[model samples]
Target chain A: MVRLITHNLLACHVKGCTTNNFPLVFQDVQVELQVAEFNPDFIRNMLSRLEWTALVNAAKQVGDTSLPPEQPDMMDDELLQKLHHVLMEIHVTDGAMVCQNCNHIYPISNGIPNMLLAEHEIG
Target chain B: MIPTPDLSHLTRHDLEQVYDPAEDTFLLLDALEQEAEALRKERPLICLEVGSGSGCVSAFLGKIFGQSSSLYLCTDINKHATRCTLATGKQNKILLDPITCSLAGPLSSRLCHAVDVLLFNPPYVPTDTDEASSAQSSADIAGSWAGGIDGMEITNRLLQDVECLLSPRGRFYLVALKQNDVPSIQSRMLEDFGLTSQVVIERRAGREFLLIIRFARTAHSGSGSTS
Candidate 1:
């Protein structure tokens, strides 16, 4: 499934589709909320790896506006909990991840994102 | 060797649904341990684990390779396995990206020739074709050990993609049973994909003889051969 953590690292892999490929736009998504055990340290460690702006934007797109627009310097419990929920709880069951640059749509069915491209789209 | 990922967070309830680390899992870990030096030397950028049940193997890999350098991507058809994998990674301080899909379903095309380390400990138990298909479609714990018809049904499908997935210096590790016909698998990969392989480790656990086989492209051969 497309979780924010996984989505954070994904970019449009279409041939010659490089710039502005990140943060694939989620459309018609079916979100399932699962509660994972909260671990502040884990979230704190993940902060450096995350694309903060992209995560907040993606969260907003998925109707989760809990995260602040910018990543706060202080590692507060409130922010960590929000990050945990955004990254771990939310699951995109059904949708298409549309690439911003290529307009290539990678569909998610049965909670699996089909990242495969056409033979011609192979880089 | 890097310590195995801490799975204390996973409860018995969770283990009931997901495939817990067992003999097969440990064999894969040992195989990875055997190749630790070579893997570090190659400096893999991307590591993909197909059917990452319980996430132990991948987490161990992340620990060995260092989390910052490579992207640790994992796939499993079972949703519970994916969740367990995520939790395991978190507990171990490894950033594992677990995707709930069947055998690199969506990742194959994009990851073409980009995966530097590929790992799979598939369902190698012999069973009827229907049972295996049902288990796979159900995406449950049964899918963890219900290989059909000589236990190659699922492995066969993945073997077709190995050549496409591996980078030039890539390494693939597979866990199999004696009944799975290890020799044929190695020969087939060599003939069809030009991939050479050797048995890295083997142990008899009860009636099942488990083997960990390592496969790599012919050009990258002399560095890590453990027959």
Candidate 2:
């Protein structure tokens, strides 16, 4: 599923797309929220690795605006719950992940993102 | 022994398109099972499988973790493989997020020095360059085994990015064949990227000799990046 957690780890890999390609923009996306076993500790551990700004951008793009604009230095349970919801609960069931740099459209269907590039677009 | 992921949900049509989990897949699972305690102790947050054809290996890894906190990420060229991977993950109750991409093409940079456990059971059969290219372009079951030029064409590209993708304490488990020049692969990784490796497990699977080589950063290589 296209969770913000996984989406945070994807960028446009189109040929020569070396800059401004992070947090692939979401467009016309159908988002689903499924019950998941939330582990606050897992979110805490992943906090350091997460690109806060990119994650916030992706969350908002997916119609979620729970996270604050800037990440809090100290994470409380309330903040962690919000992080878990934004990152883990929101799944992009159908839509396209567009590259901001090269404008390459990576379609997402059935919760799977097709990141394959065309022959001409391959680097 | 760790139990294999339940893949009964996959239909015969699915197996024909996706690479079926065979001896090679089982061997990879066994290797991971052997390292269960060590892997769990590491508490790896991000685990990625480069070509998760059947999602069997990654799903098994998830099983090893029990209450897995890790994010199991997967990538494959074949669309059918991705579909099957998701099905298998769901069947096994493991959340394997798969992307339909060539190897880890789009995720390399985003995953920079973040992956803790990286597994790859690549296409290791040595085929002609054209045949391999065609198989890759077709992105079908053939692409699962057509390894161009000594079965290193596809693996070599991923090797170049491994150092950059792995975290300081990351481990990369790769399944290779005897024909792929295993010793040379080990040497190249050491000389080129300062990544030392040990053959985790090996077996004679019919006519094909399979080995799972595990690589990790050298003791002194504090950083994952080359620069």
Please name the candidate that would achieve the greatest DockQ relative to the true structure: 2
lDDT of 1 by residue, B1-227 (tens): 56878999999999999998988898889888988998998867678999998999999998997765566899888878888887888799876777766786656655666678999999999999999988987789999999999999999999999999887778899999999999999999999999999999999988889999999999754346321
The DockQ-based CAPRI class assigned to model 2 is: high
* Candidate 2 local lDDT, A7-121, one digit each (tens): 9999898888989988789999999997778888889999878899999988888888888999898999999989888888789999999988888899999999999888998
**Candidate 2: what is its chain A TM-score?**
0.96
Once fitted onto the true fold, the runs of candidate 1 whose alpha carbons sit more than 4 angstroms away are A1-24, A28-123, B220-227
Residue pairs in candidate 1 whose N, alpha carbon or C atoms collide under 3 angstroms: none
* TM-scores for every candidate against the unseen true structure: 0.71, 0.97
**Deviation from native of the Cα of residue B99 in model 2, angstroms:** 0.4
Q: List, residue by residue over A19-113, the lDDT tens digit for candidate 1.
A: 88777898889898866656666567556656899999999888998888877889788888888899877878788889888788988865557
TM-score of the second chain, cand. 1: 0.96
What DockQ results do all the predictions give, each relative to the true complex? Answer: 0.11, 0.80
| Model 2 chain A: worst 10 consecutive residues (lDDT sum) | A34-43
What local lDDT does model 1 show for residue B149? 99
